[model samples]
Target: MQPDDIDWNIINILRESHQNNNSLARELGISEGTVRQRIKKLKEVGILKIRASINPDVLENQQLATIAINIGESSQLEAKAKEIAQLPGVLNVSITSGRYDLFVELLTFSNKGLVKFLTQELSTIQGITSTESFLMLKSYNRYV
Candidate 1:
């Protein structure tokens, strides 16, 4: 659904305070049910998605890795990316241009887990010709 001024206001208010629907109602001078209805509508029409954010460094043994994959068949890029996207720890998968056919970002909570994900899981997928992995040393900023 296209967002109007009220929808934008409601979205901003929720971004500032995600848990307080009543507070949003107060701020917007509307009923709590109205806030709930609008948010429901937003979600129903694929306008908004809510997720909790985590810092990988704060979690013990948790780390982020990006994998660049070169596929033999360009026609199978989307199918291959979809298969990779279904794997455990996958955060995002994208079909891209240039030398790489697909880029995948995933989180691993242990050294062995990363190894298994790369060697055991990734190796099982067909059409992948070569792979390069980059593990993040540190994360400074994240913007949504």
Candidate 2:
């Protein structure tokens, strides 16, 4: 379903801060029921999700890293990305252009855990020709 102007406005407000139906309705000059229904429809259609995110840097013993991967077969990029997404500690996976076929973000308990993931878990996936990992040193205004 396509979102109308009202829906977009609702989304924009929600993006900045969590608002109840009454507040959204008052701000948008719409009825509370309309605001409620629109939010429901937006979520049902997978266009919107409401959840809290935390900065990984603030978490104790947690580390973040990104891996640039080159696979043997370009045709299998999507399949490989999906497979990698299911692995533990994997946060995000994407098929990309440039020197790599896939870019993956991972979250682990420590640097050692990251090594275990690279050596033990990721080693099981075939067709990955090579991977270069970068441990995140610092981030600003980043949340996961």
Candidate 3:
């Protein structure tokens, strides 16, 4: 989905206050009705999707990790990314440039559960040459 500048500006403001159309309108120097209309159009055109993001720290027995992976082959990148996307505990996967072929984000209930996902579920997929997992200790300025 492609979002224009105004849409992006609206998005930036909305990220701070998803529920306050009046505040968004004030920030954008537009009317609340216009802000509402733009948001509706954005959602209808599939340029935007609104969802709630739960902070893992608020809950007990929860953990978040990011895994950078290097693949064995270029041809298998898309399929490998898709396979890893379906693995348990995996929240999102992206094929990236530079140092890593794929970046996978995951959340698990416990450290042992994360280990099982890394060793068992991730091992099930081939052509993954290496993986480096980083556990999130804390986050500053996280955007929803």
Candidates 2 and 3, the one with greater TM-score: 2
Tell me the whole-model lDDT of each prediction, alpha carbons only. Answer: 0.85, 0.92, 0.86
Show the lowest summed lDDT stretch of 10 residues, model 3: 135-144
**Local error of candidate 2 at residue 84 (angstroms):** 1.0
Question: Per-residue CA lDDT of candidate 3, range 38-108, in tens?
Answer: 88999999877788877787777888889999999999999999989998878899999999999999998
Q: Is candidate 1 or candidate 2 better by TM-score?
A: 2
**Per-residue CA lDDT of candidate 2, range 1-144, in tens?**
989999999999998888899999999999999998999999999999888877889889888899999999999999999999999989899999898999999989889998899999999999999999999988888777
Task: Name the top TM-score candidate.
Answer: 2
What tens-digit string does per-residue lDDT give for candidate 1 at 38-98? 9899989988877777778777888788899999998898899999999989999999989
> Candidate 1 vs candidate 3: which has greater lDDT?
3
Stretches of candidate 1 above 4 Å error?
none
Global Cα lDDT for candidate 3? 0.86
Best by lDDT: 2
Error at 48, model 2, angstroms: 1.5
* Local error of candidate 3 at residue 45 (angstroms): 4.3
